[model samples]
Target: MAGRESLPLRRLKLFQPLNRLTDDQLILLASRAERRTHSPGQKVVERGVRDGMDYFLVAGTVELKAGDGRTSKIEAGGEKALTAVARLQPRMYDVVAVASCDFLVVEQDILNQMLRDAPLIQADLDSMVDETSGGTDEHRLLMEFYAELRSNQVSLPSVPDVAWKVRRTADRENSTAEEVASAITADPSIAAKLVRACNSPLYRGFNDVRNVREAVIRLGTRTTRQLVTVFAMREVFSTKQPFLQKSIDALWKHSREVAALSWVLADRATRIDPDEALLAGLLHDIGAVPVLVHAEHYARLFADANLLDHALGELKSDVGAAILEAWSFPATFVEVARHAEDWQYECRQDLPQLVDVVQVAQLHAMIAAQQNADLPQFEDVPAYRRLGGLELNASRSLQMLTEARARVDEVHRLLAIH
Candidate 1:
């Protein structure tokens, strides 16, 4: 709820010449939208991420990248907003916000509420969808808008200096929570995001928390400290990069989904630490940032968005591996990152096996969420297959995972992880 300080209702483009909606309903809903900014070459949206309704480019230029790494540029008053054809799938490609742009980020819950109130948007959407077949003129116009954005610079964040110190500790099993907390505290912004999240309604009732120390104590020193680390990471490294931002919402959802599933998977399928698996699931995609960072404006690299998936498998295809290595994630996590897209680890190690459970369960939840293309190769994953083979067990795990996903979706949204 930041910018648009004086305007009544904003009617920015949504793809040219097809679906135009600047109704009072959309504007009233947009009144709830806050302004956000991004720099050039920064990854705005990471693929496979989920986000609520947002009328991006309330100001400034934006580039839209396809799943195959195909890039398109959009200028203000362009075709796509009118077209509504090229909305991003965060679970797939990064949408980098270029040129210090101002965005109108509307919360999902709010957007849904707004949609219910505004019948015109639905009408416009039906018109937009109905008007399309085999790449409608609207979609093409939006794609052209996307083409313009390709050259726009996206804002990306550089890891904080102390991030170097934390990655070093990853290799050590003997490392203590106190050490990590100390490092996290070094970055005030990280401390702030952590403290704010803990204090939010999500955890507000968990305890009568006062400060980081008390919050950490209430959550358990280890869990509390780990949350701090995550906060530090996003704070230090998150930027207005449109490409990276795409999947950020989905990544946040997926991580939480995996965390929820990890607990159940550990309870039923594997012998790994549920807490550790949760950490692994949440951090596994940390490698993605590095890939985007290395790609720069070469949005053309992923011409097929699914190629990013392939890139994950053979990260040698992308710079993800080196970025993970540089980010100082654990060797286990780094190894897990390497095998995350694959069915299993080459060595059949305990961590990788646990990671596989996480990966599969994430895909299962994604499939259930009905948000992506292609099912994960379940047959190839011996562990998940065996787990899935048990009727009662599989049903029970899915039940738990479904409930967890619901809880986490609510929780992360309340926390603004997207």
Candidate 2:
């Protein structure tokens, strides 16, 4: 086996967290990192040992053996390989090469320092990079997009007039259901959808509501306003371009799932408003809407799914916050949009907030879809512990969701209505 003095920067881009590093930072890390290879049956790492280096498998397969005699194999280029092997400070497993293997060894302190400096490094790069010239197509497009967004040149979706009117009417000190219903009736489609929602399985009563006014009474002013906004939000996800339609459809589907899960979690786990949680879940990714809409003008972006996903990952939070602010939504909702994907985010308040509920719900949705490769340990998520500390482990949480599937499905179906 051969060894290299310096790891390739491009190779660093393939791993999580490190993938987030700026090019210059990655180059600096690559120079300090070591690339080593081991033959089959060689020990890569020993259990219960505190090694300050992180081992990333670049090629071939490795096996991890715990003290309990349990073992798992991780192959290079697999989903699990995207992260370091047994990442804890004191190694929890004995790692051995199953075949000839390549691994990049990075000093823990150096890597952590670089990660901490990434934001500052990125800020400096942003100020210096010629957005018009150099860099990949994705980088150039992102720069242009950010420039437009900062200048308010990008178009943001507007909250429907009916939704705004209903919210305003509902917020009145002495407002009646009739007043809120009146505002909702301005948009006949949303009015009809509200009526249908109230009669749906989740909210169904012995007698069906015959009109918007009656629906408003049964669902209450707060719920009526929330439902109106939910119905109106469906329109914001539409696209005229055929190429972007699939992405829009997928986004809508994911939003609905998160919304349903958020509603259930808020109702069962915390005292937070279920309707508000549902709305937060739906709007969490609302920032991506304008990004896709803007991408319609860039043929190359939409054609390359990877580049499009990268753009969404990088820009969605900022765009979402802007959209929520423009819609005059609550600061809480704005916070949800901005930090929904931040697994490390935690509310400083004594109890969980809407953002916490939505974060747990989003992770549950990801778990249900078998997309947990890069996900942090369920117990490690601050939002999850805040919602149900120790009492709710991964298995129990999954069971809770299983029991609530019918309700989640009903909410999903209700929101899916045009």
Candidate 3:
């Protein structure tokens, strides 16, 4: 696996779309690429072992592991981020040799420089991928592809630009529909999408929206801005985390259900905007994505353990807060997402309406989603009893549940899902 046969394993997902598709030039550069060899069962790169330079797998297989002793991803070049992370703080996932292997080691800066000529490399990858098929070695190629998709300068997705702009303008007292329209119009796709959503049953306008300005006026400044943020949120919510699709999807469903229930409950509970509560509910568990997505270890930890350990409890809230804080989300929303479900050790009696709103909303969503089977009884928690204690009495709780379902329907329909 030596000579000039080494290549940087740039998977299609890692490549910025701005580069278009360039795989051929990469293969060309890879042809003259330098190779580093390792004996079978040797450590190519260990977790927490930082190296500034990055390596491309020219040959062989490796397995990725995390701090928790769980195997991360099982591939060769897919395990190289430990070295890349050396450029930062403590390394994330660790890399280990699965068999005898060769790597085309490239400095991080050099790879960045080459990305300017992405079109050529994209072509090479396209061909290489086409030639690759599932069997013995094809598994390696797929794993590499999975890892590459996770690669990027930002390392995480951000809010949509169209939604962000509208929200920024909505901050001021002098903001107008015209201003919001001007912002969203920059992205025609987003503009059209927003108009459609505003006209949907959630907003409940009889007339169809023909333009952004009119839609903005009809939806109001706060609602309009919120809608934009929700639309932008899909990128973060919809990512395919490594080997954790089912887990990710379950979180999404839970969040979405909570969001819907919260919207309805908000109307019943307070003068607060229903939509605001929905937004809060939807994003409450948002932090877990980055934890599971970036770390790669959380999957194994959750999967193997039949019990939900207390140590892992902080993780969901901690990651949730981190995500919202990074997004510059409102402080109140951040608090709810970061702490609602967990048993806060320092809390006293008489739970406030807001905390109770979040706690109850989460519980209702879980029960409705059938995620409560494994969880303990709702009445056991003091806070749970405080929020009308889940009494199915035909008056207050039933009304909340009914309205919650209706609002949940609105959210699902707005997203065009069942």
Candidate 4:
């Protein structure tokens, strides 16, 4: 087969999103993309490699062979060529060049960052998606879940009565540390956890405070209430499905890290309350719990993590907001859970709120996860700006970062990560 001429950057069908990129952005992406040429019959990428690359066929054709032996040929400039199999861990398929071909490979992380920063790229992808199924099965499921939540048919998760009393006491204008402690004492398990948390390195006082009221006074009423509520949250993370256990554990782990980071970052901004930020971070991804719970009924969706992740990404925020409201949380925390993924969101305030702190903290968590990768610098993230111009390596930021890192064990204990 004859090779076709190369298309301009803006005209390449495999890169419709690139059309919206500024010249500088396009140049930067081109610099990062690894270009390669392959002859006919050459395998482009093998399955299960975890290369994390999205391949774009710039010229000629390639045959995609699924793990199940199904095959489809995608040609350059073809409508189907726009998207690679999205970040399918364990590599869902293998691409083999069917003719002399040119390819551009971009890392999945880099592309995701671009999509996050550029609404234009998202809009372009949405348009392409609209060409296919108007309402995806996963989306339909999310809609049904929302309707059920609103109708009170799906029975939202509720904390134990003891936890509710602690929250109510803390919400009062004249509530004292003694009252908060008494409420926690009503639940022995929660009281024990609160004592342990008070002794933990994250908030350990100068000396041990054995009594519940003394511990509450030492940790402050607000902190005590937050801990009590989160203690109840730890119990709900459990599931009967053995396979789903790992997913639940991972969700709690991520939430713990986010919470720790949020608490540390909150101290830097006066307007943001560390206790509120901590709770917000802990529950930011709370929507995933119910989604996973319902998914247990659909074995196919429940088993395929990549598919579930896709659905969660699409619906978690909306479900999270609903969950928070049902729990009677304040509007600020509810909005934080609802807009957890919106890193660029800015509130009209003199200083940042819990949402802003959680956003930046989440970014830090992401950076820590990609320990060995050449991840984007904190400065590149737009959220870093909204966070009071915070820097990961600055003197004050570094101090907090060091403290947060050292308290990882405490976070693990709080979230029951073990």
**Winning model by TM-score:** 2
- The alpha-carbon lDDT assigned to residue 96 of candidate 2 equals 95
User: Under the 3 Å rule for N, CA and C atoms, how many clashes does model 4 have?
Assistant: 0
- Per-model C-alpha lDDT, please? 0.49, 0.79, 0.58, 0.67
Summed backbone clashes in each candidate are 78, 0, 17, 0
lDDT value, candidate 4, whole model: 0.67
Worst lDDT run of 10 residues, candidate 3, spans 80-89
Order of the predicted models by lDDT, top scorer first: 2, 4, 3, 1
Model 2 worst lDDT window (10 residues): 124-133
TM-score ranking, best first? 2, 4, 3, 1
- The parts of candidate 4 lying over 4 Å away from their true place are 1-153, 268-271, 371-382, 388-404, 414-418
lDDT of 4 by residue, 332-418 (tens): 786688667775566656556677778777877876786325444555545566664544343456567876565545565665622
Q: What is the lDDT of residue 267 in candidate 4?
A: 62
lDDT (10s digit) by residue, model 3, range 1-418: 3455443445422422212324665565455446788776777666565564565554577665546444533344332322222122134556667777666665444455444434322343334434443143433333332233323332444557776677778876798789888998897767777888877777758788889999988988888787677666666666555466666787777777777777777676555687777778778877666655644533322333321222234346644554454355665675676568864321343434445567777776667667676555655554455655334322566566775676668786665431
User: Model 2 compared with the native: what TM-score?
Assistant: 0.67
TM-score of 1: 0.48
Pairs of residues clashing in candidate 2: none
Among these predictions, the greatest lDDT belongs to 2
Q: Which candidate, 2 or 3, would have the higher TM-score against the true structure?
A: 2
